[model samples]
Target: MKKNIESIFKAHLEPKEVYKGGKNIPPSDKKIYKLSSNENPLGASPKAVAAMKAALEHIDIYPDQTDMRLREALVKDFDGKLSAEQFLCGNSGSEIIDIILRAFINEGDEVIYSNPCFLPYSVFSRWYGAKTIDIPLLSPNYDLDVEGILNAITEHTKIIFLTSPNNPTGTYIPKSLLDDFLERVPKNILIVFDEVYRHFADAEDYVTALPYVLAGHNVLGLNSFSKTYGLAGQRIGYAYTTPTIANYIRLIQKPFLLPLTSIEAAIGALNDSEFIEKTVQTVLDGRKYLAQAFDNIGIKYWPSQANFFIIDPPLPEMEFTDRMMEEGIMVRPVSQFGAPGKVRITIGNQEANEACVKALLKIKS
Candidate 1:
């Protein structure tokens, strides 16, 4: 007897497509530049690399279940306002997203987020049988519509997920706007701030929600080492909140949450401020260069505070992506994020950025 898998998933049958990027192209004589995933072009820090190499020797032993040492190193970076007990390290920031939903969301609960924001918010909300309330972004800029979001809230609303320098759009919530929002929002509801791109943001008015967490609000700050430390492969990140909430998340998390290598690598990354500075500086410089190139070519693109930007090309977005790949450049077609006719490109190294601009200009001509 054949069992219907769709029937098993029931309403969840419509699978959410998780966009995978940074795939290695086949070896060729021509140079290939990967500008698809918003990875640090500077690559993993030397300290992280050294830490991983040292960890390999101790693979025979089990890692610390609580990730104590790594958490201790991270505590100092937060300037001692956040204690180590308030932090929980996971495989990735995305994993923490899933963990948060599992630990908090009940069936039929409501989770609100903006459309064209992080895809995972909707995807995982639905996966947990929670109703996903998607508010559309404000037009012309694709920024969050705080009023609309506040209007969508009800008694069933359990969580609110917000991303700064939102994925695919590169737009951020303003400080004053967020301050107003936090005050207006219900104090009982949990608010999650996904600041995975915080290190790359240089906008003068762009602010982080960590202050809320420190001020005894029901807020959680989620971050990853993948983008800033170039530790994507290492698969380690952290979530910061009140010790009360932290204890609950920790209780539900699977034991042996992160491997020894990931823990050590993360510790090494937190200790290497010089490398982080260099990576951020390179992306900042490359972002400016790409913006200028796009302007000179008359291509419409978002001026981003993140390591990536979305641009509307002359051709269809996917067609533009194909042409880019054919020219030995890889970028993300962001129609999946509800923005059709636009492609998102990561800010690569100077050489890669120049090559990508040349390819894009060639395709336009």
Candidate 2:
């Protein structure tokens, strides 16, 4: 009798939905403005590009398994608030989430997060056979419902994922609410704060989870080089937590998680303060310009502290997306994010922003 491979790996073979991201635009003759993914308007830092070129000469040599050089750069970048030992670098913020899940989650355990969050949290949890609890965000503003999250907690709850300046919605949890929530959360449960868009946030009350991690709480602050550093192509990110948690993650992660070019690029990007400043300022300025344009055009959009904002278009969500594509502009329709009838638009450079606005104006007319 032939053995059934599907039956043999039944647990792993279970049909689960894969996560989807922004739509990609194929090569074309027309000028395409890809404002779909929330990427930096400015390209990669020149210093980082130079470093990546230099690293190519030594591509034959293996990278340091411990990622000591990159960690040291992070230490200086954060002004010693976190030590080298407290950081764990990974391929990207998404991979760091997977690593944490692998390190702690067990079959049938529970994970809690807001509905319409970064889709990977639920996708990854289900892959590990963890039951994901989706707590609904308060409507109108899309702020996290802390009380709802607290009420959903059970003994089986292992991890709680929180995204500040959250994707699609572009809303952040205020410090006051987070502090209160932290005090009430059980010490046994781990809190993962996804702050990949931190650099773009300028809210006075907005703060990263570093303070909680520094206070010895079971918290991890996840950051990425993708947005602010404009190193999305390099696929590198990091997480900072207590030494105990960092050490635990280090145990399960494979050696040389990143290539030399990526590490060197991140380090070089860190050293380029001028480029970083320009990127942030440009995003902020473009955000304001877009907001004013939307208001003038009589379109409703949520205020955003991150690099992107969600807009309720005059047409259907997918219809709006298709229309934008026809105009050589790619925007994301976030119905899968539990945000039906809404479209997410990245704040691009001046020219790109103008092009997007012009396309929207044409659609409206």
Candidate 3:
């Protein structure tokens, strides 16, 4: 008989709810507005839709092994400081996280990240048998604590994860603070910046770390087309880093990493600059409108730099979710992000935002 290998299996395989992409409740005939997931409320770029329709005719043919066109487009987007050789595409930002972890993390190594951050940081770290050093975000604003993170570092620390316009909280680390923090980190330790919501951030101090990558730092910027391009269903994301690191990640990636349709859709989305600009403007305007509505309704919410923000409702979270569903809206209860008594609300189209505000006022009253 074959010997049992269950004893050697990795521990703590309990699933963690990572991304809040709207719950899969029964398909009711009623129209349901999804304000749960941070998807683009404008729907996908029309160009992407058209490209996908064209790509349907070529599904039988295998995709190109190297995503040359997509990589070149991404490099051009960066304005020539970055080369096509210094990037890799993934099925999603989550897969990019896994690729980096697999490439660098070893047994008993330590990885540092903030609490209530992208949950995949902890899940994937534990999966690889690496110790997770989760530092709490500074109180009130949920800002990234550079001092706390620095204090948590040890000789065994292999990676540090930071997310700007962080999930659930919709907070970000200021560029000045980040510049100082980057200088203090050990040269050997890898710094991974997940800027999945970069396009939505309009705060004065918010900035991208691509310059650091250009200056030859051990930092990688992981981003997704899901939010900016409304292609969450397409599951396409990319990472920008040094060519050496990019080559290492590429070595461990799947043979046919991204589907042909997703590739075409991303290319199309990139071409539609007008659509992307309109989507960003809509989110910005809607954010201001919702903030005003929340103020008038007496609901407490975080000042957001991303397309979502955390709200503390008077009613219990599940009750709030149920009530919103009755009002034809779906919002995510985010006790999962360690913020009990609060929920994450994705900024949606003007109509959806107005509907959510109206529902909240009713619940509160």
Candidate 4:
């Protein structure tokens, strides 16, 4: 008889809850308004669907193991000017995050991330036996403190993941501050810029960390088809960086992680310029409308440049989130994100946005 198998997972396994956006319902119900996950309220790009459909018959063939089509589509903005070697495609922006961590982190190595930022980065850092350095955001806006970040770096520090228009808070790093940080950071430390919400940014000079990649610095920019292209179901995401670094990550990732149809769909989404434009407009309009609603209702919200904003409710964040869920309107509670009294509300479609406001007003009353 075999003895009980020992748990292989290391000691630092601080389990994170797998989030389900809303209550699962039978197909009989017509609609459920979900504003929990920061997903595109407008669904997948129509052209992406057409492209995926076109590739349906070719299921027998495996996807390009190297993810050529997806990479090519991402760099199309450069007139094919950017080399294809500088990209790595994988199962979601989340997987790419995993790949980078797997490639760079090791025992005793250090991984740094902003607090109340995307949860996965911190979660995986612990998973890989690296020490997780959680940095708290400074006042008014939860901004990345350049000086504090620089001070945290040590010889053991291998990576820093910064989320622009950071999750939950939605406050972005200023151009001048980012530029200053880049200049001061050591060349050895690779910076991972999670630009998943970059497309939602409204500021003109809102500096994204992409230029760090283009400038041949130790930086890589992560993007996903989930939010902007509305392909979360397809699970395609990518990293853009200098050829050498990108190739390193690509080499570390498992082959064929991205499905052929997903790559094809991404290509289609990119080509359909109008759908992408419409998605952008929808998010912008919805966010503006929600901001006005929040203002009129006297609910304080942090300045957001993304598809979601941080609601600083007078009641506890967990209470607010639970109350909204009871109303059949799901929103995210950042109380678990190490922040109390704050909830992240995604900017949804017209109906969803209106319903959420109505729920909030009712709860307030």
Misplaced by over 4 Å in model 2 are: 10-13
The reply for model 4, stretches above 4 Å from the true place, is 1-4, 7-31
What C-alpha lDDT, on a 0 to 100 scale, does residue 141 get in candidate 1?
Answer: 92
What lDDT would each prediction earn against the true structure?
A: 0.88, 0.92, 0.88, 0.83
What is the per-residue lDDT of model 3 for residues 1-365, given as tens digits with 9 covering 90 to 100?
Answer: 67678766666544655544457545889877898889998999999999999999999999877787899988778878899989889988988898899999888999998877777888788888898898988888888888999998999999999999899899888989999999999999999999999998988889886988988899999999999899999999899998888888888888777889999999999989999999999999999999999999898999988998898877899998889999888989877776777888999999889888888888889
True-vs-predicted CA distance for residue 352, candidate 4, Å: 1.7
Name the candidate that leads on TM-score. 2
Per-candidate TM-scores read 0.95, 0.98, 0.96, 0.93
Which stretch of 10 consecutive residues in model 4 shows the poorest summed lDDT? Answer: 19-28
lDDT tens digits by residue: candidate 4, 1-365: 66554555566665655433333332434355678888878898999999999999999998787677677777795467567888888888888888898899887899888787777777778778888898788876787877788899999999998888788788888788888888999999999988889888988768766677778899888888899888988988887888889877777777777788998998998888888888889999998999999998999998888899898875787788778877767787776675677888889989999998898899888
TM-score order of candidates, top first: 2, 3, 1, 4
After superposition, the stretches of candidate 1 with alpha carbons farther than 4 Å from their true spots are 1-22
Q: Candidate 1 lDDT, tens digit per residue, 163-213?
A: 898888998988998898999999889999989999889888898868888
Instruction: Specify the poorest-scoring 10-residue window by lDDT in model 2.
Output: 5-14
